[model samples]
Target: MRCLENRVPPPLLMVIIGLAMAPAITPQLPYAAPWQWLLCALLVLAGGVVVSLALRAFVQHKTTVNPLQPARATSLVSSGIFARSRNPMYLAMVCFLTAWAVLGGWQWQWLGPMLFAAYIQRFQIAPEERAMLQLFGRDYQEYTAAVPRWWRWRTK
Candidate 1:
């Protein structure tokens, strides 16, 4: 299991998990209401926007976006979408998976996102955090303190 860390690309892992869970998504709803389709489209669009913002932030900061090379990052990005979620790209992947599950119309399909999150949290994110801390030290710690790894809503 340790050997798997940072090895498999997240998008590939997401597709693999989704396909592995397909058999359990059987007897999907016979019909999708127009609103359900609209919801799915919205979710995918949101995911795209998030990942795009994350990528643009990385490019703007001149940091390495390679998940396999977190230590190579030149800057710690903590503004814009990054200010909200430390791992917006991963969150976007979850959004994409959630949209698929919604369209599938089966409760079990939700496991795709759940499993992906768990795996990423343990395998990808943990190691990435270690690298960030090693590279950026207190600045990385401050950023983590200010932002959740995933999204959170505020009610103030």
Candidate 2:
């Protein structure tokens, strides 16, 4: 399982999971209407914006955005969208998968997003956080204490 850490990209994993879940969901679910499609489009757009904001923050901080190498990050970004979620990229992928599920009108499609979150938490975010804790030390610790693993309006 350790070998799976950061090996498969989150976006690819989302797509694969989304595709795999769709067939099981679609046949058993109702068809989406125009309003649902519109909502799905909005969700995809929002997801894209979330990812873009995170990437821009990384670029501005001159930190490595590469998911495979958390040790290579030059800085700990805690401003902008990073202040809201430690893993906006992963959150964005979750949003995208959710939107895809909505587009298909899959009543049981919540599993796709749930599975993605579970996989990311175990294989991706956990390893990345460990690496960040090692690389950034106290600063990253404080940031984690302030921000969340995923988006939340208030700290808990």
Candidate 3:
């Protein structure tokens, strides 16, 4: 398990999980309604926006966006979409997977996003955080303290 950390690319993992969802391993749910298709489209669009923003931020900051080489990052991006979620790219992937599951209307398909999240949290994010802490030290610590790894809704 430890050997698997930062080993598999996230996009590859996502594709593998998506492929797994194609088979009817569990009971299938009812077909999606027209409204569900609309919702799926919205989710896919949102995911694209998030990932694009995250990549743009990295580019603007001149930081490495390569997930496998967190230690090589030259900047700590904590603005724009980064301020909202530390792992916006991963969040975007989740949104995409969620949209797929919803559009497919399979009971087990919903697990794709959950499994992706869990795997990313343990294998990818943890390692990246460790590298960020090592590289950015207190600045990274303060940023983490102020921002959630994922987005949170404000409770009024």
Candidate 4:
């Protein structure tokens, strides 16, 4: 969440909440799409949420409520979920975007996921990683060398 620090404007959070609620707002859409697509979206959403939350709880235990700034972290998380993906929460957001697109039967919503990934990579993630690498040194280097940027095909 270092990327989420003070950099996240108040209005942006509100906008994110609203954008994220896009699927829920369109109640008619949940009944849309083929069942297979809906099921796939559900599974993806559930898995992503579970994995990401577990990783955050287990590895990033320290709360960074104000994560936008470059500051020293209370802990250097390198085990559990951190060992897998450096940006699981961001990946989870992508999963949510994909799921919402499918669940809403808005194929155009697929753009949501792609756009989210690009935006996060450019704005939040890349910077946080550079900071992390600088803070954690060779430890972070080794982790990055081993972990996939967006997935864990090599792990499980």
Each candidate: what lDDT?
A: 0.87, 0.87, 0.88, 0.62
TM-score of each model, in listed order:
0.91, 0.89, 0.92, 0.71
If ranked by TM-score, best first, what sequence of candidates would result? 3, 1, 2, 4
lDDT per residue for candidate 4 within 19-46, as digits (tens), equals: 8658653774746658847675785876
lDDT of 1 by residue, 1-156 (tens): 879889888889988987876665534545766776788799999999999999999999998899987889899999889888999999999998887788777777888999999999999999999999999999999888888999856611
Q: Give the winner by TM-score.
A: 3
Best by lDDT: 3
Better of 1 and 4 by TM-score: 1
- Please say which candidate is ahead in lDDT: 1 or 4: 1
lDDT of 1: 0.87
Candidate 2 lDDT over 1-156, as tens digits, reads: 899998988878988998888786666445667887788799899899999999999999999988988889888888899989999999889888888777765467788899999999999999999999998899999998888899879645
Candidate 2 residues lying further than 4 Å off, grouped into runs, are 24-30, 154-156
